[model samples]
Target chain A: MHKKNKPIIVLLFLLPALVLFIGILIWPIIASVHHSLYQYPTFSDPGEFVGFKNYIDLFNKQYDFGKAVINALILAALSVFIQLPLALGLALMLGKGIKGERFYLSVYFTPVLISAVVIGMLWEKIYNPIYGIVVKGAAALNMSDVIPPEGLLGNPKTALLAVFIPTIWQYVGYHMLLMYAGIKGVSPELREAAMLDGATDGQVNRYVIIPIIKPIIKISIIFAITGSLKSYDLIKVFAKDAYDCSYKVPSLLLVRYAFHNAGGIASAIAVIMIIMCFGFAILVNWMFKERDLYGKK
Target chain B: MAKSNEISFDSEMYSVKKTNKFVSALIYVGLVVWLLIDLFPLYYLFTFSLKSTEEITGTNVIGLPKEWLWSNYLRVFKIGKKVGASQVRLFFANGGLERSFANSILVAGLTILICLVAALMATYAITRIVWKGAQTLNSIFMLGITIPMHVALYPIYVSFSKMGILKSYWSLIIPYAAFSLSMAIMVCTGFMNDIPKELDESACIDGCGTWGTFTNIICPLMKPALATMGIYIFLQCWNEFMFASVFSDEAHYTLPVFVSNLKGSNITDWGLVGAGLVLATFPMLLVYVFMSRKIQESFMVGAVKG
Candidate 1:
């Protein structure tokens, strides 16, 4: 295979597609880092140089960018902490000898398959304070008269949390599937040994199963973090006008800014995102070391 | 513990086994409760689609429809007529409702092809080429896996518009290829590593060149990974939103974009919208039903980000 002098033609074969990937995908990111240093001229025009001004505007020092950063981090942390473990527990349940695993897996996964628009609609109905089924369901449960009728989406206080519910619901199955694969990858003999040693199910899970599947758990958490950081579509549907005009996540904030007269600010946001994502990814990589397997989180 | 052995419980020892049963039952109960809550949302959609406006607009979405209407599905298709000019011209015009099935087929099909060919070619270089910068190319593509689609949106919008391909399927199809190349490369390259090098030497001894060896040798061997990546790439395109929204106009609406148009109509039809939701989600349903294993493997392979 070491055709030592294979004319280097192979490199040429890779050049075109590589160019597109590097040129469009990678270069824009690099360019965004540069542009963010300038001031956007207008929505359509390429921006002009304005050193550190936009970045200054981002922080509460001058702008409220800190709030957006705080909110985005909160949302990401919440998704990872809350969503990942719940999915792990559920995956553990099904990974055992659940009788109707296939049916239940499919049923649980139904939410992730639908359009984000439709998901927003479905939850919109459920959260409807007036006619939302949750209100009526609560009323039927006899906890009613004092309860206010309003979808969580309607309340500014609860809006972000309310939206987070659907976000968690929609993708839990994906994480569950990932964790399930992790559990499945474990060697069965060790589990049987734990059982033979008079270990109870809980002890087996605590000592053996969880430890074996820890890599997947870490991967699932990483997936959850990046996913929540990058989330825009689901929020676009559910949180449309749900938050104040100024309220936005880093992802959506940049997206809206990208469409304006000029996108210097948007470019800056993209740079921040790439840096955060890269820094986090590198952190994970370093944690995993060259082994590419993270032992446990 | 001794009492269970003394009683010689059922078969094996550890009469504490009943506790295990109880725990499993409890696990089932918890899973079942969440499953119901999780699935109940979909049932609400189903029931709402079956109901008249009065029923959905009623307080209980999951309540049985006053009357089940199968016609709601038909109405969605018919709503194509009034899908609106912005809606109609952008999507439904040129018979998008009719053309969508075919257009999506082409876009998805072509994207899958580009990803496969490009990734396979590049992966070979990563695996076999010891040339400098090959490793860098491999990691860059790997890093592309986590690069949010939104980050690339505006720059691509400006570029594609500048190229005058804005609103054409090429805009999406090309970008989709670019977006997915990293994952595809990582996957195929992993599989390529496990492929022994002797196969290539043997082929080259018979006068195969780079492209020739790829098409004749590697292409055939790469089919399994290619198939798995193909499905992932296809689903990504099928469900892609932001770019298809920003890059393409109404007439070029993909299925997800078309489904979003449900809201834009002055006269909103929740029933038809639900029906369309089902339609929009149909591909994934089919995938989960039949291709879940492959889909799972795709993600597992993709877990190795560049």
Candidate 2:
């Protein structure tokens, strides 16, 4: 309901959001690329331009960014292979018209609603070596040797798995809810038709229901992958220093360097993170599209 | 021949019913197992919060506390009192549990305010007005949904440090509002589309300027959408740990940051940290208990639209 040539009012309306968007998100990305190419010994002095040194230094033994990225990739793999399947199973089960469907849905989602910090702390107490349930239970069961004296989080061997368990536990409900919504949207006529052909529950879910929900599954995969790559909160709770930890991720290194006068290296890590997140997102989308076409044929 | 067919069909139905009952019974068992796994940790958090330090570290690992000591929760508020002339206390001086709780409310409140006003105006401009480049601007805002906040962290850290607001509320508020804008705008625009164009037309016919129409006609009808967006935004700001920890100091520490620091400063007090965690999570649990459906719906809306 506007007359022509009211550009001023439109600009006014859009300016605040656009400015915040660009300044906080867009400009930082551009600045990250620029800053990555320089050695910022400190923020005050944007020292001499050193082309790809910062990026290369990331792979050096000292930074070990390559390992961090690998760890993140492992987490992403776990989310897709382990976490997403569990979520889908739950969603499929709940979609079958259970008795307390709403109750189950809300209970499953309680973990996702709680902050990662709180979840991390809760898990930490559970993992506490001295009086933690893990040690106490192990002792009660006569398998005390399984846990190291320093605790699961203290040992590099088990720390990664220990940290990832709670992280995965917290978000399973999230993906389940997403897939559950998708399943709920499936028309009952389609299901009844499938059953009319004498298809069992497993077969209906595998062939009929899954094919209909591929797009949502694809979205969930993208989210799962991207979310894992940028995972920091829970992992941070386990690894306070970021360095000298087995469960290091890119964001941990990014934060450490950002405040430690290694801004160039931090910016490089940030740039790589942006690239990987966008890259995986595109890759997942394309892969799903290809499968859709193949299925049609 | 017809009687024989009916007899076979009856036998088949009986077997299917037996299998269905068995399968559903198995499914119920599985659902109950998962439900226990989900609720156990939360139950542990609450019970642990009421345990004494002695019980937490000694004889009582998993069971309920022998004698419930609510004093653990009281100690959570008195965190900074014992850090005498220590480096952690510099940041821990005013960094009590209560201070951080207030700080979190202020940061989250200001963020919601900023996002609502900015996103509402932007949604109006994009959906209602006939401006050149509106499509382009809308696309730019939409592009933000995919951009991870990590990309902006360091640069915003740099810029905010230079502006000398790195340790202030703006440090968290500005970025929180900015990061929240895309989803807020998306939800608003989605809702705004359903708002009939005739309302704006009638307002214009009644001599209402663009501003007048937005204030009088559109804002009131957008309440449900705004409420949905408000809860979503509140959760994001409240649970945010990264920027809150980095940008805010002891004086401005939010709940997540405060609870995290509680562990560090009070190393031996597991029960106290549990109390702090409970305090941090209590608001969210209350929200979940009351508006679990709305919270779930908000996330669903954002996901589908994104």
Candidate 3:
């Protein structure tokens, strides 16, 4: 019933979102790329064109972008190896038509609903050296000497791990829910057939259910990796204004540079983050697709 | 021989059943343990919020407050009050808790409104309209999902400062709504697909134009989707910190930034900080309680970077 010349109406409807998207999101990315190539001491100052000097300088001690990149990579590794496995285990268990399934699902998801700042603050209190539960528990167990005088978050060896603990904990339910939904989508007939073939529950999950939910698992891995790389709030909460901390991620540096008249460095960090996120996402997708092809062959 | 085989099968079945029970029991134990880990911090936060500074610092760290002091919450509310400042004067001060609460609500509310209206129209244009470049336009918006907002921070700051909207609420609202549009359009498109195209055709037959059809037909039908998207947008805007912190001044601080700064600016009043955390989380907790299923579904729709 609609003809072609109703273009005005379509344009009217699309204009607001398109303008906002281009202005706020797309154009700034272009601006960031442009800004990263120069000696942008401040937003207004657009200094001499440094030509990727900022990018190269990132690896130096001044910026230490390489270390932050490595820290973020370590977090991505932990998410894929440890966090995803735990989430998968919970997803598999919960997928088995468990009792109080809804209750468990909702309860597990509570942490995800709460703000990261709150989670970070809670952990800060929990790791407080003098009054924290961790120290108190250690003292109660006669392991007072084991815990350093400077608490878990204070110790260089443990601070990154300490910061990551809550970060990983907060999102286990998110990945679990994604996997749970995927598991639920597996036809019951498939499970029943496997059981009738004398397969135990573990065997069925290993050989049948796991294969069926591989796509979800792939997506989970991508999300886990990208999410870890983009992680800011929880880590920032733990490492407040301490730019020299061992647990610095790309984001902390980005914000610090943006404010400290180092716009070029900040833009360089932002570009690298975007690249790494897109890279990992594509890499995971490709890895999963290749494996699927091999399996099919 | 047949009878002997039958006996062996029966015994095997019995053992399998017994182990299944044990395994299920173990699963329950694991789930319960994780559940406690999940809930303990929140429980501790609530109890900690009510504890005296003495109890929190010295005697009881994890237990319920010896005396439930609701005054900690009141103290958090009365944060900006000085010895000489009048009540009404301090109430309007940026340091007061209520100002952040108002800021957060106004930012979140405007973000939700802008996202819904803009995304709804855009989704209709892409999904329902028979335009030549609709598919191209849709993919362009989808690309926004992959690009993290960090890349835009410096540029946004620059632009906002240049445009002189750096400290205004629009600084937050515009960017938030813009970023949220991708997810909103994604959700709206999903819902728009399920709505049979016949509605638009039938509406045309009934003498309704494009605007009339959207307003009278599609908008009403998209209510559930809109609500789900609104909630997601609300969660994002309310909990956002980095941009809110950078963009806004003291008087314009959102709840997350406010809660985060609460401990830093003061002389470490643990109870008051706890109270502020509770107050920051209360709205989200209420949303979770009432609309958990919708929230989960919303997460599923935008789960990848949500």
Candidate 4:
């Protein structure tokens, strides 16, 4: 408790985490940027200093990094527009003190606890062409013609959407729980007051609950977007052995290149991913702040 | 005139109540549909895991298996043995469900332990200690939350290789702990801020040293937050695939990687894959089932507070 020893004691406590944080996270980003500037293919040999060539090479067809970016962005968009709304709907619905709320919450959130690999495999079986649920269901309904024989994940055109479906489904409960917590934090008096003013349930939610939970919505948006950009596990399961898979996202590309001795290109993708994630986080916060001001007006 | 107004208002209320009932019914229906969709895959997973290979490959994908084959689970554990072998070994000499399960537990447990200690100390310092540059230190740690983990993947890989620790438990444990530190610190600090400064002052008055105060007063009070964080760090490490896949070789693959690798090799063996999936899934699901409230609270608290 000595005043002079305070700083030393604090330093002792903070040292381990600070060291690891710098060693693992902060240094890596710096290293990634440095690595990106060179033609470094692997760690053993420092390849030629290629300047911004790796960054430039990323957009070209040879790397298809541009396509990966576009795919990641598209996934981010779908997450915000499709996934968040569905989650919001569930949150709003369940936030109303419904019966079996805990049951529903656990059921929906079960996927979040399970490994993405398991979820991928589960969906893969469901989408299996021969004996999967899709084919069987279509056959039962006498609509087998509508089912894709090659399976959804196998088809290039449908692979992205198919993969995105499970990706989105896997986390619907995550965003829903976030919003649900926000919704529950909204005072009952506010809802009652709105109802006393002759507002409908929808009206009360729109005017009273939604505004109160806007901060949470913003967080969910940031999470959904950033999470989509960095998504790899489930997508990897779907990719398996496919070369140039249609659903290649930035993380996938980063992994592929990193393993294949394209360390510079991989670092470029990593830098881009970090940039996108941070950019989206800042943009979402800014958007929310701007909207808050407008709403006040 | 007053009676007429009252009657009209009552009628309006009745109609609104009627519509509310209808809407509530609609909402319940929607929730049930969502619930079914949410649960169906898990249901299928369990049922498929129970089915024989022939039935799984047959056209009865959605139906109950004619004869429930608990043997699939047995075979998952009995990796090198024949199906329905009388003497079943719990620990497979070959890398199978047991090894992967043990690996996942060890890696996740160590990661959580290391992360908690580091994060707790850092959080206590940042929140409780009044030092120069404390605010800046806090900001630096906070910045880690937004840095995508993949950015660190190559650097970490290269570093571990250089250090000759690649494919070892430390490689996974180090990064897992480091990556989780930001959020863990945020959660811990947020909780620590709530414990009144009076507690520390009182401890000091009792002639308690800083270490003593931290051990007796701070650590005890930190149980709930620590539990929440433990579940989180455990789940993150358990469910983690990216680092595990990259850092771990065959001998050290965690459950997720093991399950996925099984899928890759035994591409057509849905039953065996389902068994592997079940093995990977049920442990987490069991943890979630018992500790759902804690898990959910931790996730929400971590997000909201951060």
Candidate 5:
């Protein structure tokens, strides 16, 4: 709050949090972007500011930066596709009057309770070729001869996808809970009326339910997309020994660059990531402008 | 032929009419199947944590082991090695993850306590203070959610290091208190909105000051939201990997950092790792199981305000 005589008190209340946010968050973001201008040094400060050199380098696919960006986008898109649809399907199913719905919801959601590192380790051990569960299970099924010995995590072909699978799996119940809440809030009379008109289960879900829960869908998708883009911990843990520091999606990409590589380019990557996420968020919101569905219009 | 066709058609119609039961059963079956898929890895870890390494290697990964290693929990409490076993005092004691956990608790605890008080005071001003710029404060907080914490880590680290508090708890505690303000304020403001301004006015007219009025009137009414925010803040601090990872050393490692650190070479003690995970996850799970209903309701309440 601000006023002529009240400026001091107002500033007193406002200064601490805002000042820290600006000092710590905003300034670093600005500094991080600024840092991207220079040629990175080996063991010292940035040697000089070549105005667009790092940006040029990134654009020209120097250091495999372009690949990282593409990988990040694909990871986000893949996660959104997998996590949202499955979660939405579960949300719709459970939102139906299943007798033991809450129990199932909690049970399905237990994975979310554990740390990301643990999840990564568990899955990685399971995907270990020599002693992992999948290979052993295949051997047990007497199909070991038919399949290759390479496990998903070690195979470059399936490595990203293998990592992505758990990233998607972790959030299913979280998104399901969000979507279910949104679905539950919808008036059941609409569904009942649709059914009374001899509407099939498909028709009820398609015509009435989807329209009502569109915001939840958008919110869930936003989270899924953002989450996938920010998926670092799992991959970091899962790919512990084998993971090259630089070979990853952008969140980890930026991390590797900043921690191991210098700051300027990493800052650029960070800025680009924030923009990409916010841009995608805005686009989704624009696309799913469901005001009329919610009756606000 | 006509009589047989009629009989088949009637039976088919009867089956179709019972579709809800069929679908519900299918849903239950599908749910249980998915539950098995999702829970097996975690349940395996839990079971494995209770087993010795020998048992883990001998048995299938899916089930209970021959003997449960109940001592692993005790092992988690002590350091595997102490510095200079000839036992001289060192700059750091290489023992007691429980000590580091206590440090985390102290940092998170004090930070949250301060955050709650400060946010309560500031949020009151934003909602109840008859002045301009209130909207700006609120909007800044809403925008704060989108600003990634990593962006803030650099300056905070540099500044905290400059202040000679790099390895100290303040490195994390201050930033946490600072960064988590936006979330706390938003929730606090929302709770404040639900309590009508007339109560504040009446209290003011009766000679109560701002702090007194907040302490007496506003805080009590906001219990549900406060409880929700408390859990949110606790979880935020408890599971925080970044700030702790960057800021703290071995002496101050939070549970997340400890778990994150188990990825070191020669640290292939998956059994100990499993034990650590159970230790780290169980407290949060305990809170979740008891408070899931309230926590779920809290989100709905927040959505209404948003």
Candidate 6:
């Protein structure tokens, strides 16, 4: 290990990652931005330079990129407000050292491990118009008049909510597992002290455990919002065709345009999605900073 | 006066304990209900996969099948066979399921291997090796963590098409490895940082070069983190649909893509669709069942740090 060769060794060790990172992640993002400015229809032909026209076209009725953005935002909101609270509740409950904790933890986390396609397929069956459990249960309960017989996923009015349930459900366990780990790491001494001072379980969780795991919660919020914005696979399974489906997310629209040979429009959508993801991430960090409980400078 | 105060306090404490027991019971009941909600879908999927088409479509959807058609699993693997007069069953009509399964294995395996080697080296350098610009390099890699994959999709597709590698496994492998590198580096680096610097110093004193120290001392110590990253990487590569769908043609379709295509083509055949879902889900399920703790720990470690 000569001192002279140390820098070379570092370079040698880092070359593969640097190459792949630049080639796959960095270059594509740069190329996406560049392509977004041009009216390139195909790879061979660069076509005319369109500047911001592609971005403008995205908002027009023909492209409906605005709708896609709205849909993703709606999903992001639901993830933050609904999905995360559910996960926090579960984490707190499980964090209390319940019986069969290990078993419960594994059961809850199983969905995160399974492929979204599989979960989507399974849910699709459960939402089937004819023989689905929803229909059957509604009938058996004599509440068929209320529940949609044509399947919730097929109905334009309920499709977004229907599609989002599984999306939200699939990740509840993921966030739960994260919060659970943080909860577990909270010192037993703090909890004991709180209890000794006559703090109830709820109070201890609220004042002690929750505050201690604020950073983890903040991270979860970022993941939830960003992941919701970039969501595709499970939504894809339900949507099938992006334009045709009632629930259209940005990724679906991006893929649709890419395949339709509208490369510029697709790239524009890509750039917008990237900006939104990054913007949301920064927003979350700023929000967390404003509410920093530790008061660190 | 002191005795009376103690008596009142004891009575109040006893009442609080009674309510606590009731609250505990309520919590247990709530947990049980959630557990059922979580497990029911999987159970239904399994049972539905084993049911006959008639049974599945019948009014008795909730009931257990009278005769479990275990052959549905067999039928999924079988290609080009007519089940009934009106229905023609073909699982992998043109190198469908089996080919896609092999492709998934190859892609996932390669991604994990490449990602590990590259991430391992980069992590060792960034964390263990003291360098001038190491922190800057680390920050750059960290930036990759938040960049949405969609931003990379269109460009990668165009470039690969231009290079005439759009339909090959390289298209999928390279991006999978690349996109996954950030988290992989983060996890490995966290683990590598935990290995006492004293060990590296001792190894250096014992005539071990940087490469030798990394290989003999650091690599073995990184096994747990490596395993965790391996599982996470494998899951990501296997279940990755966005890049695989866009990049790979039918001949090179991975399992997720194949399964998706199967669902679309066989929209009417619930049994076959169930079988396809089962096929796609089983491998990951097995991995989870065996390595649940490691996966949880790794995910937490990566997530908490972020």
Q: Give lDDT tens digits, candidate 5, residues B191-302.
A: 7887898998899899886667778998888777777776666666776676787788778877777776655632556677677778777777787788777655544443
User: Which tens-of-lDDT digit does each residue in A97-213 have in candidate 1?
Assistant: 468886787677667656676676667667768767777778779977544445566655676787788888888888887777677666666766666677877787789988877
- lDDT (C-alpha, whole model) for all candidates: 0.72, 0.86, 0.85, 0.85, 0.69, 0.84
TM-score of predicted structure 2: 0.92
Order candidates by DockQ, high to low: 4, 6, 2, 3, 1, 5
Q: Lowest summed lDDT over 10 consecutive residues: which window, candidate 2 chain A?
A: A288-297
* Native contact fraction per model: 0.42, 0.65, 0.65, 0.78, 0.27, 0.73
lDDT of 2 by residue, B276-304 (tens): 88888887788698989899987887776
CA shift at B143, candidate 6, in angstroms?
A: 1.1
lDDT of 6 by residue, A162-270 (tens): 8889876689999999999889878776766676677788999999999999999999999999998999998888886789887899999999888787989999998
Scoring each candidate complex against the real one, what DockQ results?
0.43, 0.54, 0.54, 0.57, 0.35, 0.56
What TM-scores do the predictions have?
Answer: 0.89, 0.92, 0.93, 0.94, 0.87, 0.93
Model 3 per-residue lDDT at A79:
89
| A1-297 per-residue lDDT for model 2 (tens digits) | 345548878888888988899899899999999999999999888999999999999999999999999999998998999999999999999987778999999999988888898888888888988878888889999999999988998888888788778977799999999898888878776766676677788888999999998988998998999999999888888776888888899999999999888999999999999999989988887788744555851
Consecutive 10-residue window with the lowest summed lDDT within model 3 chain A? A288-297
Clashing pairs in 2: none
TM-scores of chain A, one for each prediction? 0.87, 0.95, 0.95, 0.95, 0.88, 0.95
Please provide, for model 4 over B90-152, each residue's C-alpha lDDT reduced to its tens digit, 9 standing for 90 to 100.
354446677788899999999999999999988888888788898898888888888888889
TM-score, cand. 4: 0.94
Query: How far out, in Å, is residue B234 in model 1?
Result: 1.3
Which is superior by lDDT, 3 or 6? 3
Candidate 4, chain A: TM-score against the reference = 0.95
Badly placed stretches (over 4 Å) of model 2 are A1-4, A290-297, B1-19, B81-93
What's the candidate order when arranged by decreasing TM-score? 4, 3, 6, 2, 1, 5
Per-residue lDDT tens digits of candidate 3, residues A8-102? Answer: 88889999998999999889988989999988887799999999999999999888888888889999998899999999999899888778988
Say which candidate scores most in TM-score.
4
Best by lDDT: 2
